[model samples]
Target: MTSKYMALPKGMSESSFDAAIEKFKKALGAENVMIKDEQVRPYTKVMMAVPTEEHTPSAVITATTVEQVQAVVKICNEHKVPVWTISTGRNFGYGSAAPGRRGQVVLDLRKMNKIIHVDPELCTALVEPGVTYQMLYDYLEENKIPLMLSFSAPSAIAGPLGNTMDRGVGYTPYGEHFMMQCGMEVVMANGDVLRTGMGGVKGDKAWQVFKWGYGPTLDGMFTQANYGICTKMGFWLMPKPPVFKPLEIQFDEDSDISDIVEFIRPLRISQVIPNSVVIAGVLWEASTCNTRRADYTTEPGHTPDAILKQIQKDKHLGAWNVYAALYGTKEQVDVNFKIVQDALKQLGKGRLITEEMAGDTQPFKYRAQLMSGVPNLQEFGLYNWRGGGGSMWFAPVTQARGSECDKQKSLAKKILNKHGLDYVGEFIVGWRDMHHVIDVLYDRSSEEETKRANACFAELLDEFEKEGYAVYRVNTAFQERVAQSYGKVKRDVERKIKRALDPNGILAPGKSGIDI
Candidate 1:
């Protein structure tokens, strides 16, 4: 059953490619190995500023079991083929499921979805790569398991395995995804299986509970790198709280961002507010429900400040919106809520929006849902802000200081406006660090807009680096530049590790720009 001969992997002729395809088909069945044009189209959708063909997958192989993944990797190793892996393939702004380089087979693992184990006593879970947040949430609810999940904004469609492996963030107290992970099961490039942390000990019961397994921690390396395919992983789940109260604090002026950061840091560090707080911009709050720029104005590029003020007034939102929560029993929540209230009150610029007042609002509802471990897709509405469906998340990390937050915001806004783009971004305040996430939204259909967006992204990197600021995560297009933002010695060590693990380069080649 052959459709048409398309491009093959590098250094391989059509016959050799056909032979590799046959081997894949034989290993996973013909229905699971997708080489047809239509079957591979979904895997080619990329949001980065690069040619679509450059990131297209040559074939897509879906495996249902760890043994099947091992067999497929063995075949790719034999043929000197590179294989990119994805769990649920819903990483929207970060290239989705597309490989870093083109002409590689996508080891799509959506078929291997299974919740292997759930320990209610320990509040731990073991799941396959395909076990999505929504699936796990439903399972816990159905079984009346009193455990909650920590997931990103795009939670319902994204899997825990993919998000956790990427070290993504959420809104809950367990917002730090990777920090909460306890165990991981990886399928190496050489077709060997490994269990990290306590999972290495045979018949060990603390694999998922105890993270440190006696030696150097290897789980951090596999994350955000293409060293191994994580077939299964175990993560700690947030136990059900006796009480939950989510709060929203809105400031009237954009300049109030500095004070908000200053005030919230003490609360966050003091555990008065145990969860990660989102200090979102005005545009970010509005975009959750506002679909088009034309709705307010026909002006192109960044939305005018007057128009933004109008949006803030009409939407009853703030120049900056802060979403945080209080957990524990009713007594504990009341005490902590008072502490949070006092913190905001001292700022003298923040207006607290209680849960009752913010009932079913844009940023408020979504933030509450995330903090409670309920998955929702309302965050995707940001893609419709400028139309044309172009997006790239430019995330840079900084100290959770108000002054640093203010400086980053000002610089990013200036660069974005210069490029004729709007600053639709937010700051998720960690205990001591903050992730300043900005979505570079533009109209991909317009060639001019695309060109400017690309230039703007490059300049953002350069200017940010000049200010001693470094991006924490980036889209697939600028991974190399982001990697080089650090010194050469760091990348040298990464390359050495990549070569040691994947000598044949059969794993992801350009992932995070570590191609050795």
Candidate 2:
């Protein structure tokens, strides 16, 4: 298949590429292997404007069966070709559904989406990589089951495997999805399959319950790394609470963030706010709610100083918003909500706004976390960037380092401003750590904007690293830069792990910038 974006590297041979494609088609079946330009084109680009020319896959394969995935991996291993796995391709702000390396085959697993088992007695479900939150919710509702699963507010199209693989957190008490994962079925680079926890031992009931193995806890090794392809996983689910209440608390001053975070830390550790917490800055709130307002859209290339002026004039500057939920029996929710309200009042701030939804109040009951409500930012179609374009850099930050976060935000805004780009999304994930997602939104049609966005992102990474921040999740485009952020020791350790698991270095080469 030929594509304008498919620019083969120098010294690469057409004969070699064609042979690789033929071998892949033979192994995975021609029907499952996509060599047509139309099928391969969309898999070439991610969400960011960082040109798709660098990581255009030679083929896009949709594996409907684990046996097919194993066959494809074997063929790729023999040829020493890289493979990048993607599920649903709904990973917005980061890279959409694109491989991190060029000439690699994209393993699209959306077709394998299925909820294999939902055990109400154990409150756990075994799901394939393709299962999404919306799908799970609909199925449970249809079956008249009583349970709640945590989900991100962005696109419900994201797969359960993709989100958990990235260690993405949600808005419920069980917001830390990866932590709840008990077992995983991974396809290694050499085509060998491995299962973690009790899944390795036949007929063990603890396969989806206990996380520890007799030797090592290897579940974390698969996350945020290209060591293997996760086909199946078991995750814990929450039982339906007798009563759920969503609450919101607004703070008028920026300084209040530190106090608020401190107040919530103990509560979180005590399992009071077990799900997750979000402390959204005022500018972030304004961008999502009032984009149509003349105040925001009127000025193109508005400086940070000007935006701050507008925010202050609008009485929204330094407005810190928090979302939290209360679960359990009616008495439990009532008692918890009162305690939270009283705590907020002591801080000289507290307000409750009624949510639009009534039944199953799980979404609105959270005041410290932001994932429950429908992610309003996604409504603008900002996450979906057509063509080979758009990108996001997510990093974890300490909530106590409010000053440092402010500095980082300032630096990011200044860098994007210099490049004539917008710093679109920012929010807190864990109560004490911040997930500052900077969306480099630009039209793929504009070559200049795309180039500027890439350069600006590179520069921002440098600044963020110098300031002692680390990336939680990175795209294949900036793999090298992200790797450089980690110190020599950590990088060395990561390389060793990669080499041990993938000796041939044929799985996701150039991804995460590990040479192993």
Candidate 3:
């Protein structure tokens, strides 16, 4: 079951590989390199489909310092071998720690994890590639600091650098994590170094805010591309808000989603609701929380209609759930809550709930805790959803016209259903547009399920492209489909950029499906 695409170079000899292994071991201590069959095998296969039964790596080099990373890259460049950079190897669906092209040595960076600096005055933090959200959260809370951390939904174990590099979104005001990043230190394709923003200037602190040069914005070039190894990066931190309130609005019918969308658009753009607004369908919440037994039935004869009926009977089918956070003064939150309630009532849909629903438990307070950006979900054990294998696709759409949003949702659901896959569509309302993240979950163990999932994803891409919608984040498994959405012209332009930045195509070669 080894990947045919991942074999050693066609004519590579034992002596050549042995020589490379010796050089790697000499550069990095023997303990830092893992070349055993069991160790290197898992690093070879990705988590998209079930990993191949056997995986053999030319070598696995663990770099403890940036200098070692440079040495590893230098060696790979000299030998024309590929190098794959992995931090924690938790990138489930997008080929975790596995190189897209075969024969590449895995560059594990978990050892480089370090919170080098936390500048409260400048409101920025410098971290290595291996720092996890959980680690950052613990540091912030243990110190009882006033700064806020914006983290993705499953903030328990995912690395901050990998999430930002992939453009992961969170539920706080600074949900766009990548946009919050200011500067980075990248090891280019030929073992050279490049710094973004003011990082190029010696002894400059402007990297905490300024994000542009006299010419182009190079930071974006590193994201979702085969550009270079991002060794160190700095991201902006949210100042602790005076008050945080998490609110939810519930609905009971499918047609009411459009009404809810229309009601929130103005509030989002007006800065009244500056954070990311998520409108999750009831089914999505049920599936994610495992509260709806109807959907997770183990019986072979289960039907969607039966599941829908059960959900309705339990009154758990809250046609939709809207989640938002209000920051500022306590008075401002109270005012905003009232405005939101009143607006929903005007549309004949005001049945709402806050932490008040749990009475003494205080769900609002818990929502505030989440808004604080601390990683607390591990205690609940919900982090084990995928059995350690799953993928996420982020699709962004504008809400200028509610009808168009509805149409897209309908088309997406129909396609997913056609393939017998479960999908949850969440609406992330930005200032002027909406990012409808369609979270698709499937079992990687079944080959039939894997093929069906791929087909459904491909169909959705074709339909969305024809309708003028763009996918914000795509799994490495479907990179080609995602690049095609940008059209031939943009693809060519991206190719030219890749060639200019990475002439050897050594860094993240198969990522984003961009070729030189």
Query: Which prediction has the highest lDDT against the true structure?
Result: 1
Clashing pairs in 1: none
Q: Rate the local accuracy (lDDT) of all candidates.
A: 0.89, 0.69, 0.71
| lDDT by residue for model 3 (154-199), tens | 5677877888988877778888899899898998877778889988
TM-score of model number 3: 0.90
TM-score of candidate 2 relative to the true fold: 0.88
Q: Which parts of model 3 are misplaced by more than 4 Å?
A: 1-14, 50-58, 292-296, 299-303, 312-317, 359-369, 378-396
Candidate 1 C-alpha lDDT tens digits along 1-516: 543533467777778888999999899999999888889988889887667888888898999998999998899889998998999999888889987777888999998889999999899999998889999999999999999999999899999999988889998989999999999999998889999999888889999999989889899999989899999899999998999998888888999888899999989999899999999998887888764678898887788899999999988888999999999999999999887777667667778887898787677888899999998998888987898888999999999998999999999999999999999999999999999999999988888998999999999999999999988778878888998998899899999998998888888888888887
Stretches of candidate 1 off by over 4 Å are 1-6
Q: What value of lDDT does candidate 3 attain over all alpha carbons?
A: 0.71
Best by TM-score: 1
RMSD of 1: 1.5
Colliding residue pairs in candidate 3: 6-102, 355-363, 355-364
Q: Decide which is better by TM-score, 1 or 3.
A: 1
What's the distance in Å from true for residue 468, model 3? 2.0
Question: What lDDT does candidate 3 reach at residue 401?
Answer: 53
